[model samples]
Target: MTTANLPDLHDLRERTRQFAQARDWEQFHTPKNLAMALSVEVAELAEHFQWLQTGAATELDDGKRTAIRHELADVLLYLVQLADKMQVDLHAAAVEKMALNAIKYPADTVRGDARKYNEY
Candidate 1:
């Protein structure tokens, strides 16, 4: 779908839930399984750029880009499923984490640095 027409996170989560429910797949969608699946998908996504130099990944052709997109969708689906099963609101969790990160890595101190928060 186009960027403007993409489904919202809640809608996507609902749809993913329905898809799993319809397939009686919830038994197989435990947080551990979903997390593992998410990790695999992330690895697959990383494979696309494994040997590429900086800025090369963004130069992928349409087919490679499409593959990357599908890999990302897979990662998101598993992450959403895992969060839903754990009764977590993904958006809220992300916002809260960002807030904590902002505190841990204040711009004035962390800007242009790649060190861990503890090191900063």
Candidate 2:
């Protein structure tokens, strides 16, 4: 779906919270557990590209793309739940991180380079 049609992060967070509450699953959604689940979801997402070269990966069939989409949704859901449990504003944190990254890896200096900030 397009960004304009999507629910804001706060709404998504509340919806996720209600989902867990309805299922009585909030007790299992501690930061640590959510983090582990998020990691597992990431691994599952990566599995789709495990054997494919970078160029070939971009040419995945519709089924693989659908699977990747679901995996991505799972990742986002887990992250939203984790952020709720931790009382962190995901949007704000992401913005702050981008600002920090800019300072750590200035575009002009880091252009065409993939090295870490210190490595450059």
Candidate 3:
């Protein structure tokens, strides 16, 4: 489907599944490999932020912003691909995890808090 016709998250996930199936990449998309790739992409993203003032980040020029965007997209694409590879429901997993986190860090007790979970 064209970008305009692209579906929402769940639908896109299904499309990702179909794409992987057609390409026969499931066998090579093991969790370990996907995780490694994700880590590498994250490092690439971090490289752009290294030693930069926090406010200076989004101030990137168009070319720099585009480059950073590409790296960010790589990280996201790998994550979605990993979800497809693992046959996991990313949306549900995200919701469930967030719920668990809310319990672990109730806002009344943790609002504006910056401590680790165990500390909280």
Which candidate has the highest lDDT of all?
2
lDDT, candidate 3, 1-120, per-residue tens: 664565566566666667778999777778899899999999998888777777275667787778789999889877988887778777889999999999999989999999978985
**Each candidate's TM vs. the true structure?**
0.88, 0.90, 0.78
When sorted by TM-score, best at the front, the candidate numbers are: 2, 1, 3
> lDDT ranking from best to worst?
2, 1, 3
Clashes of 1: 0
Clashes of each: 0, 0, 0
Model 1 lDDT per residue over 1-120, tens place: 543465587777888988999999989998898999999999999998776775275678788888989998999888888888899998899999999999999999989999999985
Q: Which ten residues in a row have the lowest lDDT in candidate 1?
A: 1-10
Clashing pairs in 1: none
Q: Could you give me the TM-score of model 2 versus the true structure?
A: 0.90
lDDT of each: 0.87, 0.90, 0.81
The alpha-carbon lDDT assigned to residue 76 of candidate 1 equals: 88
